[model samples]
Target: MKNRWIALYVENQVGVLAKVSGLFSAKSYNLQTLTVGTTEREDVSRMTISVKADDTTFEQIKKQLNAMVEVIKVIDLTTMPIHMKEILFAKVFNLNNEGKTEAFQIAEVFDQGGNVKIVDIGVDSVLFQCTLTERKNNELITLLKSRFKKIEVTRGGAVAVESISSSCR
Candidate 1:
């Protein structure tokens, strides 16, 4: 199954997220990532959810979401020309000076044009944080696995929007 991203514009109210998530759980659809935040209009909230499903399952999810009272709009982002990003903070342990230097180099390469940085450095653990596209984030993880001992990782689920034609561009 391919990854699908769904953007849901919903009324900002209690139990909205729960109700939305409950639908997926009830249907046995696997949700890979879900990020929710308020939009510029405080009364509305946007939820970006990533799931692995085929066309039939995705259509079912969309139908159920549209039926919900809280959901204002549902967009399938998978086929859209979208700008997507995710934040990841990874800690690597058991590093010596040589390992630390290697980690630094890895961070430099993966940082989205230098946006990523070393957030914390401990005696044995080093934390690096970066906001990157999904592919780059996975690349960094693969590098860490092959080169260093990974202690833990925290990822902010992906947030995405359709790429709109800008007058400035």
Candidate 2:
């Protein structure tokens, strides 16, 4: 199966998300990640949906989504040159001061000069916030999984847009 990313611009009204989700369920499609937020215009919302499907099914799904009444635009980002990222919020159990220091060091190294923030540090736990590419995020999770028992985890589904520039190299 090929992974696909689709962005939908829709009217910000009640039940819009439900209707869109229902369409996926009705078609027996599996949605991997879905992120929704208001656009520049308050009445319009942007949804980024991630799914895995074959070429034919991808086309069919896009067509159906465009036919929805509240949908303003549907962009298939999978085939485009786009930049995408996912945000992660995680809480790691820290049993002692040594564990806490280790957690902080891990976060510092994993930040990679990006938007990684230490949200909280308590006597027995540490919370972190990171915005990273999907691959890096997964790597972080794996690293943490081997080290600590995660108390909580949250993933902000991917958000993407077409790339604007060519190689600066």
lDDT of each: 0.88, 0.88
Report the backbone clash tally of model 2. Answer: 0
Give me the displacement of residue 122 in model 2, in angstroms. 1.0
On residues 80-148, what C-alpha lDDT tens digit does candidate 2 reach at each position?
Answer: 878888999989884588888888888899886766777888879988899888778888888888888
lDDT of 1 by residue, 30-100 (tens): 89999999999999999999999989898989999999989999999988788888988989999999998
Each prediction's TM-score versus the true structure: 0.93, 0.93
**TM-score of model 1 vs. true structure:** 0.93
For model 2, how big is the CA root-mean-square deviation?
Answer: 2.0
lDDT of model 2 at position 102: 84
